[model samples]
Target chain A: MRATVLYAAGDVRIEEVPDPVLHEPTDAIVRVVRSCICGSDLWPYRHMKPDPHGRRMGHEFIGVVTETGADVGRPAVGDVVVAPFMYCDNTCEFCREGLHTSCRRGGGWGIGGVDGGQGEAVRAPLAEGTLVTLPVGADDPLIPSLLTLSDVFCTGHHAAVCARVRAGSAVAVVGDGAVGLCGVLAARRLGAEQIVLLGHHKERTDLGREFGATDVVTERGGEAVARVRELTGGDGVHSVLECVGLVDAFETSLAITRPGGAVARVGVPQYEQVPLGRAVFMANITVSGGVAPARAYIEELLPDVLEGRLEPGRVFDRTVDLDGVPGGYAAMNERRALKVMIVP
Target chain B: MRATVLYAAGDVRIEEVPDPVLHEPTDAIVRVVRSCICGSDLWPYRHMKPDPHGRRMGHEFIGVVTETGADVGRPAVGDVVVAPFMYCDNTCEFCREGLHTSCRRGGGWGIGGVDGGQGEAVRAPLAEGTLVTLPVGADDPLIPSLLTLSDVFCTGHHAAVCARVRAGSAVAVVGDGAVGLCGVLAARRLGAEQIVLLGHHKERTDLGREFGATDVVTERGGEAVARVRELTGGDGVHSVLECVGLVDAFETSLAITRPGGAVARVGVPQYEQVPLGRAVFMANITVSGGVAPARAYIEELLPDVLEGRLEPGRVFDRTVDLDGVPGGYAAMNERRALKVMIVP
Candidate 1:
């Protein structure tokens, strides 16, 4: 089986790897049909240290179950399914509270000897709880959209939910990445009255507009804050979706949030310390959102995608096969592709 | 007239100052009947730099309207009124949104030429917006509790509100100050099923238990987190009201918050930066709350205070006359008194 591995910074390769086998009664052997490069992957791609033993990559995928352990009751052999970026038992107290990312027995893919999604096959832990069976076949035209249920789309929805976006909410989305664009859609779906996309990329911003961004601000830093405040009539927006985890983006989110507003961050932060100072405190601002509980959100979003009310798959502007995994990473890292879909 | 002044850290005095006069069309002269030293006031009492011209002290008071400018329409002369710690025009957008602290034309008392609440009389800015008329007389037994509505009580309510405390909520209050004790009361009022008070002070924790703390954790730092996690069945609390602004308190608040929980802070932060790191981000913890919008909350909380349903004034364990203002500050600063009331 061919799988994606990272040897060091800017070095992604597709190499033949041993096929995965079920190691637990709750496990299932999944043959991946679709996976993609994530925005977060760029972090390591830019700074990973050299290592003789390469690291497995990828954590999003739609696949078909090839085999299952005796105790795996759902997503039986031959069933198509989508797996969230992280695996969890779903029955833990945290998972019951709709926070699967914090499940007591949860763990991430491509780490701790688990199989990565960007491979021919994956040995899924907690198969019964992690995999959401898809009604449609692998050849369905909606595969691209369904694939997003694994990570990106759910992440964007998490941002909107955390920000408390609702009808008549004035919102600002701070980023042009696939997640940001998806946030615009999510906010709109949640009935936000106004959405301003803070993106300099015309191509991405154009799609952002179609996805329900009422306006776009291409400025950066202070200028961006000023522009967003101006667009919202000087009160700033009711909610800020900080889809870019950079410090600058976080600062901008805080600056452009109105008094009593919220800033929801979905992008994995690159910095540790945050300026939660007197100004933010005095303004009654709330900062929330985190690693999305994709498993919890998939069911709610699936109906919309299956009914054609949503088309999150539009974020994938380029596609590659298993051998092109390295090129896929480069395209996204160089900003040449919004998101690259890997059809293996 | 005499007013309290802070010349330097540990230096407080009752000095003769000019009588306050209406300086704006929206202002009114308020003769101080009751005021109190706040937990936040201790901040400057500990680190204030020496000044040739001292800073005016005190921002919580219940007073009588002595005179009014032409534009001051409410609280006619001779009316007893309670002023929020900060002044704001209630008609401003932020004020209308219940964030009076961020009002467009708002300003704080005891700063920028405004008369301090510890003075014989204060020139109340935005009088119509800042002063909420009291039905009771200045000498009413309820004076102490009414004075708390100016800051402490409303501040605790703000913490509970921001933390989203509600029916069945598991709440943890991190502080034993007047505000944190009030937070315990507020959480109970909001129907929290379980309330934990994290304080080592027996006297304060006794009051916290009376106010509705179902449990108390006396341990500090990591032990405190462990105790709280143990009390909550190892899952942590759903809401953390951080009334201690120290970094350690903030960290502890985060450590004991369950996934998807909120930490609401009302203490004037002693530090600027916060550890909004990967752990906090990954747990979907929300950090909210700041300066309380006392003006916005006064109306809703007034009835309960007046009906004997609340006794926030119990926090004031000591009282002094105008001449004893300096001693009052020292008493609170040295922890000899829970809170000190001024009967000027």
Candidate 2:
């Protein structure tokens, strides 16, 4: 099998690797049809981390099942599936409660010495819970769209859920990256009456509008909060979706949320002290939303994408071939592309 | 009218001020029978801001209505009433939405220059919404317990609501101060079966147990979290009530709360930044709770106290005359008094 492997930071190469075989009864092997670069991948891609051993390159993928172990029941061979970035045993108490991201046994694909999805063939654990099978003979043109259902789309949905976005809510999406753009769509799907997109790029803002952003605030930080207030009659937004994992994004989300409102932050927060007293208590804010339980949202969100009720796949602004994954990494790292979907 | 006036830090004096009259159409004047100095009063009392104009000192009181404006509807003359620390019109959107603290009319009482309850007479605005008429007569011996229903008890109840304390849930109360002690009672009322009182004072711990604290964690900070976790089968308490606004108390509340649980913070977060990123997000915690809408809970909670089902007034460990308010403030500031009920 041809796979994209990272020898070191900024060094992704296509190489022939041994085909994956089921080691666990719940494991299944899939022939990759579509995969993509994630925003978090940029963390290791940009910074030169000294790892002498080569590592797997991707986590998001939509593929066709090639083989299944004895215990794998739901997905049969030749079935198209969207695999969530994280794998979990759905029968666990945590997964039953819909917190699959923190599943006691689930592990992130392509992370922490695990095999990844940037390959022609990949192995998945807990297949029944991790893989959502698409209908037979689905249009291949929608592969890129379905591929994003693996992570960011469901993540955006989780962010919307965290903020407790309700019907006719005034919502603000912090960060104009793909996840934030998807969040605009998620908020809209959740019936947010007014959606504010915070970003500086024209292309992103245009896509944001298409995704149901009613207002745009190009300004950042405190200015962004002021603009959201200006849009919401000076009371700030009723719900804020924070998709960028930066101090500025988190603070902006807090600043623009009204008292008794919620700021659902899906961003993987880096080292930053979030002012909980002044921003949260005095304002009476409720904060939730962390790692998205993609598996939890896949079934509900997938049909919408297939029917064109949502175009979350529009976030994939670029495409790459199996051998062009190195370029895909570079394009995403440079911010020249929102997301890069690779066909293998 | 005689009022407990704050002249300076540590200098509270019983001064004759102009008698309060019905200023607004919805106003009512009350002759205070029982008033208490709150833990919050220690802030201004100890720091003694330069207020040359002087200000009244308390907010928790149960009184008899002496007069009412034509528009004051429910509380007729001679009716016993329990008025909250803050006043709300209860007709605005915020009030309808149950965020009465941020009422649309901008009426909050007993903070800074707002007329306080530690006086011979008090003028309560938005009378219909701010005051609850007690069924008991003027000289009821239960006035002390009824007085607690005005603020601390209600504030504690608000904390329980914010923390989402539920039946059979484990609750941790940070701070053994009067409000914190009352919070223990509130948690009991909310059906918390395992209540951990985080306090060092034996006297307060005894009072906390009396108020329904089933467990006690005397250690502070990390040790307290460890003890709470030990008590909750290593998952942490389902809910935590932060009654002390200090940085350590805030962190302890966050540390001891279980994942997907909440910490209701009622401590007046007097000007400080509460760090919110790693501890909050990684653990998936929700923090809520602020100034108790005493007017909102006084009706529901006062009945329990009056019926002897709740004994929150036991938090008032000391008593003082109107002229002894200076000493009362000192006692609270010096940690010599849990709470002081003032007789005017």
Candidate 3:
């Protein structure tokens, strides 16, 4: 089975790896049909040296189940499914609370000894709970969009939910990445009255508008905050979605969030400390949101995608084969592509 | 007028000051009937040297409107009213959003050029909006309880409200001062099923119990969090009310808050920064709350106090005449009293 593997900084390769098989009653073998490069992957690809043993790369995927273990019940072989970035048993207290990201016995794909998702076949732990079967056929053109349910789309939804977006909320999304663009979609789905996308890239901002952003503030840092305030008539937005993991994004999220509002962050935090004490207490804003519980959100968000009401797939501006995974990373890293879909 | 004045650390004095007179069209002259020393006051009293020019002290008060400015509307002269620690014009955008603490024209009593509430006669800005009239006579025994509506009690209420306290919430209050004790009462009033008071003082904890703390964790910092976690079956409390301004108290509040839960802090944060990035984001916890909008809550809480349903003033363990205001600060600073009331 061919899989994406990282050997060192900027050294991504498609290499033949052993095909995964069911090792536990709770496990299943998923034949990867669609996988994608994540923004977070670029962190290690651009900075740290990959393990000498070669590290498996991808966490976001959509696939067909090739085989199921004895303990698997619902999802049968040949069924198309969305695999959230992390796997969980779905019955742990945390999972029951819809926080599968904090599942007591769960681990993420491609990390912590789990087989990565960007492969011809990968072993899925807790397949019964971690995989959500799509009602649509495997050959549907919506595959790329459905692929987003595994991560970015659900992450965006989590940000909106954390910010408590409602029918009349004025929302600001602080990143122009795929996840942030999806946040515009999610905020619209939640019926936000106005949406502000703070990004400088014309291409991404255009996509953000298509995803339902009512306003675009092409600025950074304090200037971006000023722009958002100016757009919101000086009260600032009711909710802010911090989708970029950078400190500036977090700072701007806090700055432009109106008093009594919230700044919900789905971006993986990169800063070791945040200045909530120096500012938040005085402004009375709720600093909320974290890793998205994608599995919990799949069922609720799937119908919209299946009905052709949502096109999150537009975020996948480029598509490639397993062999082109490295090129996909390059495109994303160079800001030439919003996201890359790898069809294995 | 005679008022509590801060001359230096350990040198609180009852000094002669110019009597307050209504200067603005919306102002009111209030004869202080009941005022209490707050926990925040001890900060300056025990830490910083007061400037040679004496600064006015005290913020919590219930008083009679001795006179009204031209624009004063609701509470006329002779009305007994609870003066929220801060004053705001109810018409401002922020005040309309129940964030009077951030109102454009809002100002805190006893700080930033405003007259202190402990004075014999203090002119209140935004008198029409900042004062909530008491239904009962000025001499009612419940005046003490009604006075708490001016700050601590309402502040605690703000903490619980900001934390989004629900009917079955398991709440932990991370302070033993009057405000924390009031949080116990506030959480109970909001229908929390279980409340934990994280304080070591027997006297204060006893008052906490009376205010409906179902459990008390006496340890501080990490140990206190361990006790709280143990009490909540290792998942942590559904909500934490941070009523202590210290950094340790803030840390414990975040530590003890359950995943997807929140810590609401109404304790004027004394810390410069907090490590929200270390744990909060991963845990899906919200750090919210700030200065209480006491004016927003006073009306809703007054009937409960007037009807004897809530007795927040039980937190006042000591009382003094106007001339003994200096001794009141002394007792509170020395830790001999939980709170002190000045009978002017």
Ranking by DockQ: 1, 3, 2
Query: Which ten residues in a row are the worst by lDDT in model 2 chain B?
Result: B105-114
Candidate 2: residue B297 lDDT (0-100): 77
**Model 2 steric clash total:** 2
Tens digits of per-residue lDDT, candidate 2, A1-344, equal 88888777898888898888888889999888888999878877766576766778888988888899899998998899988988888877668878787677888997654568888888898888888998735457777677778999988998899898989999999988899999999999999999999999899989999999999999877777788898999999889999888877877888888878888888877755767664467557777787888888888897898886787889998989988889999988888998998887
Off by over 4 Å in 3: B47-53
Candidate 2 ranges beyond 4 A from true positions = A5-18, A136-139, B111-113
| Weakest ten-residue segment in model 3 chain B by summed lDDT | B272-281
Q: Each candidate's chain B TM-score?
A: 0.99, 0.96, 0.97
Compute each candidate's TM-score over C-alphas. 0.96, 0.94, 0.96
Worst 10 residues of 1 chain B by lDDT: B325-334
Candidate 1 segments exceeding 4 Å error: none
DockQ of structure 1: 0.83
Best model per lDDT: 1
Please tell me which model should have the higher TM-score, number 1 or number 2: 1
List the global CA lDDT of all models.
Answer: 0.94, 0.84, 0.89
Once model 3 is optimally superposed onto the true structure by TM-score, how far is the C-alpha of residue B36 displaced, in angstroms?
Answer: 0.9
